[model samples]
Target: MKKFDVDSKEVPIDILSDYILKNPEKIYGIHHNKMEELVGSVFKEHYNCEVHHVGMSGDGGKDLILIESDKSIVVQVKRRQSRSKTETASCVRDLIGATLLNGSRDCIFVSTADHFSKQSIKHKEDALAMEIIDSFELFDIDKFMGVLNLHTSEREKLWKELIEIK
Candidate 1:
């Protein structure tokens, strides 16, 4: 199994997923807290802007955060591992309808998944005024393995995945 930066406290998946599955009605209540932080971190690095994660009710997500500067950004996060395009697109659709993202600078969909479709990117460019980035860009291997000496978590996982991709 692959390891993640245990440096960060994990959002409880079992409780969150179960709550989502059981009370599909109350999912926003359960995951908003955890999702916002992850998006805030991603936005800081990717967008280079100050963003906030607000857990607004009826936001239709686990994490609802805003990244703002000269212009505001609305982000909807899906904290799942790699999934099919259908699943990814679903999150995109919800963010659009919320109008929370409208008139804001940009709309973003953040995921733990390692992949996305070209069609998704095209739609993002053409229709949504958004962008889609995957885990690969977020977690590159060489920089991570640079700190490795002997079986380090970053070195081991990062190097192996980098080699496999090449």
Candidate 2:
């Protein structure tokens, strides 16, 4: 099994998949909280957003908070060891509740599992139907956001330099 530096700002998608998605045997050894950190870092690097880790106890179902411009998006991360253990509707409901409670209309549910239960997908659709949430994106391993853009990398480097100077 391959090891990962969870604290790194850059995480290759293949490495993430090897441990979290493609290899079932390796998944059990993966640390759930560290996976959340990796996901948060990926989002921070890819979107150039301020990603905050909040996956501890009483996090209100949100693992990460992504702030971009004036919008704050709640993110829920699920690292399922078994492929059969899909994210359920209740998870979606809790995320919906959390999103509203956080005063944000947008949320994203991320899971290492290959897919979510049908009920979960319907729940997300229902939330949109009722206009309770402006956006509810469900991302499985294959559906994660794409690679970081060049501009984002440059921005990250500049930010690191500024931090070093301070």
Candidate 3:
């Protein structure tokens, strides 16, 4: 088995993917805050944005904030225990509210679940149509891995990482 420092400031996605394949349990067993950190790091690296982890009590619905020039994006992260569990509409609603309250123009809801409930997708579309939010994005485990540009093999490991927990 191979090992890499999960606590490192900048862990390359490929290396992290390799490590996850070798130790799926280790990645799946990370604390919620650590999962937020990992997600933040990926966004920072992939989008060249500054990420702030606001994962704590009374976070006001956002776990991470991404800043790119004049634009700031609020993000809510859901680390579900099971991939079969679907993220609900309320999560999207909370993120939308948080983005508006935070004075940001965009929001993203990230989840480890295999998918978001149809109601969640509808809520996001409704918010967009009403111009309640400038933009909203939902990222499941697959989309999360896509953002990191993980190869198919690496992406499979992520799915396995979630599955092993079940």
- Which candidate gets the maximum TM-score versus the true structure? 3
Ordered by TM-score, highest first, the candidates read: 3, 2, 1
Q: What is the TM-score of candidate 3?
A: 0.77
Q: Write the per-residue lDDT of candidate 2 for residues 1-166, one digit (tens) a residue.
A: 5556633335564455444443444543457876787678677866679998889888889999999999999999987766556888899999999999999999999886778889999999999999999999988765652322333456558889999998
What ordering of candidates by lDDT runs from best to worst? 3, 2, 1
| lDDT score at residue 99, model 2, on the 0-100 scale | 97
TM-score of each: 0.46, 0.72, 0.77
- Each prediction's whole-model lDDT (CA): 0.44, 0.76, 0.79
Error of 2 at 22 (Å): 9.6
Can you tell me which runs of candidate 1 are displaced by over 4 Å?
A: 1-32, 45-48, 61-64, 81-86, 99-102, 128-166
Clashing pairs in 1: 51-67, 53-65
Off by over 4 Å in 3: 1-18, 21-27, 149-166
Output the number of the lDDT-best candidate.
3
* Per-structure clash totals for the candidates: 2, 0, 0
- Where does candidate 2 have its weakest 10-residue lDDT segment? 144-153
lDDT of 3 by residue, 45-159 (tens): 6667999988799999989999988899999988776677798888887888899999997998988888999999999999999988888889997788666455535456878
